[model samples]
Target: MLQSIQIMALPLQDLKARIDQELDENPALEVLEDRETISLDSMPEKNSEVESYFENSSDPGFSSSYDQAAADSKQSFMENALSKPESLREHLIWQLRLQPIPEEFFQIGELLIRNLDENGFHLEDPELLVSQDQHPAMKEMISIIQRFDPPGCCSADYIESLKIQASLVVDVPEAIYPLIEKHLQALDRGKYRDIARAEKIPEEEVLHCLEILKSLTPFPGREYSSAEPTYVIPDVAVTRENGEFRIMVNEEEIPVLGLNSFFDQVFQESGNNDQPGHAEAKSFVTSKIRDARWFINSIQQRHDTLKKVALAIVEYQRDFFIHGPKSIVPLTLKNVAEDIGVHEATVSRLTRGKYMQTDFGIFELKYFFTNAVTGTRKGGGSYGKEAVKAIMKEILEAEADRHLSDQKISDLLEKRGIKIARRTVAKYRKELDISSSYNR
Candidate 1:
């Protein structure tokens, strides 16, 4: 049961890889059919007969060809297949080549850039990397590379990078430089009032500076990171038609698995044999067949749970399915578990790393389960945390130039019968990555 729970938590790519590993290790498990690896671009062009067959085919595997609910899944997965990402070093080197500096300067610049790590911080001291003859030019080379596209590469640390970036900003506040150099630690700790008192600046100005600091990229090279992009293939899909929701498990990615006929026959014969080592052979065959069947059953049950959980979500949050994400109401794992007659942990495992495709967009199954916003509503209905965030975002965007404070936003929310504290509003604002009113 624990192993089954563990398997259910695996995302689509991991699950596919697990099955492939089992196939390679177990000769008894055979792929009766598999469409998971098919390159849609290279698929045989559908003739009239193929199209007709696809339209009428009773075989469930052909659903990817004509399934309305999963059509987006097929198209989305194909488009998401990414090429290798460009490395940080490659990005910096390319910028260095375009500088048109002296040959020695260019050489030293390339060396400094190469010495930098993925975060664009120096792997070794720039001064130590150059010879005595080249020491005078090291500062120049480092400075040049730091001015590359990411704007803060080849720095001593994130603070130095931030300071460099601050220096480059046009019309930057004088307090900004000192704030980065001296008060960055206080800023990170959210001790805005203390920093203001120490610096003898207005509290509002300190907060404004904090927002500016937040805007700077701490890990500049991450923008051009070589880390592979993870592509998501939704495990389940929910589509609405005629004001009704349809739930489907993404079965296309799962291969058709069956025991090898030869292995099955051998297992049957081994049970009846009396030759030498007959017991050992029977034991091995029985173990393999049992393990194979367990694996296949686990995969099926994983999807079954996934589909059931998705259906329960659609039914429980029917408003979300019909009207989109903002209409999503408050829900929890316990709520869905009760609706589907399963344990909360069972629902959690099935929903983990699982995504659902909807008309609104693709969202992880975990996204639907949100804590309710506490407080009295004029209409007596509770709000979802996510729905509240969405409403807050809409309010902010619609009044972009207003630069409303958290307190003001909280007041506005109250007018709409959703009462929440100013601090909660501030927290959600940060979560949405919206700069404070000072920065806005």
Candidate 2:
């Protein structure tokens, strides 16, 4: 290949910096400051008439004083809420100290507990814990630890947990114990009649025993652990205005950047050749102005891209915005990219960690895309999986009188021209945390 001198396009990083500099010098572009929380319900009746929703109030006294108080309280609350909880190992050791056991046995239990998962299940077998000296009695010591509260805490498997629970039963129902020991799958599938016939007991008795089984805690360690709830901060806020959906970006959640005109004027006036330190003044002004401008443009670009992407999402998932999540149809990255005239990667980046607000609730920008269930009459009609789930939820909610089976749901979808298999309906239903017909 012949070597040749060639000029290629500027790197995105360099372009970004250049854009930032231009934005700094330009007065039209402004970076908004971090805004205070605004109550959507309390917004003025005519939002369009308001020049800028982002403009700050001129009430300086109330602004500074109230802001200080709010900041302090928020900091205190965050500190209190964010403290780390004790780990699973520490919890196990605490519990162990309260129990009476031989020193060597306690040591074994400690080792076993250390290897346990957060669910308190023994991940390794007790046989592996036995050293040459402890080999003989190690099995018995392991058995004793297995008998802890949350019956299955130290068990190797869920079957062992159920077995431990069964062992604790005072009056063993004739075949209930054995049936539980062997046919857990059959019970799970709601084959109570088969189990009852095999065990020679009434189906009601089998169900009652199953009820007892259901009461047992499969994971006892949950009480000792803390689970953090995710808080979704909406990027766009949708409101009902004149019986129509009006969308607005939640400006209160993000900071705004704007130029300080006083500083800019000072720099400009000081940078004249006649000034004592004109060069230094020019350099400093040039640098600061460049930085300020870049910051402002980056913020604006972020807002513009976010708004465009969100608006496109709104247009695509209009049914969902009007109705709810269930109305959300299966959509794809390509669709949005094509509609917005951007690359799939651009769409991905825009949607990353971004959320939207709608009449139904706040959701991530990516949540709108779902795979369609092909061959379903309605399913083929541009409906996404989210829409399918929405329809399923609607049907279930309306049918308060009785539970709708997966097959029944499939048939209903078929009637609506949505072709879906029974299993697919079951899978989506389960994903939604809606249990089977019997359980429901």
Q: Which candidate is the best by lDDT?
A: 1
Off by over 4 Å in 1: 37-86, 91-111, 124-152, 158-223
Residues 82-104 of candidate 1: C-alpha lDDT, one tens digit per residue: 55566889888888888879998
Model 2: per-residue Cα lDDT over 72-184, one tens digit each: 99999888767867666676677777778778877877887777777777777766877877865566655766666555667776677777777777775656677767878
Checking candidate 1 for backbone clashes, the offending pairs are none
TM-score of each: 0.74, 0.68
Model 2 regions lying over 4 Å from their true place: 1-92, 127-130, 135-141, 174-177, 196-205, 257-296, 326-331, 371-382
User: What count of clashes does model 2 give?
Assistant: 21
lDDT for residue 435 in candidate 1, whole number 0-100: 83
CA-lDDT, candidates in order: 0.85, 0.70
Candidate 1's C-alpha lDDT? 0.85
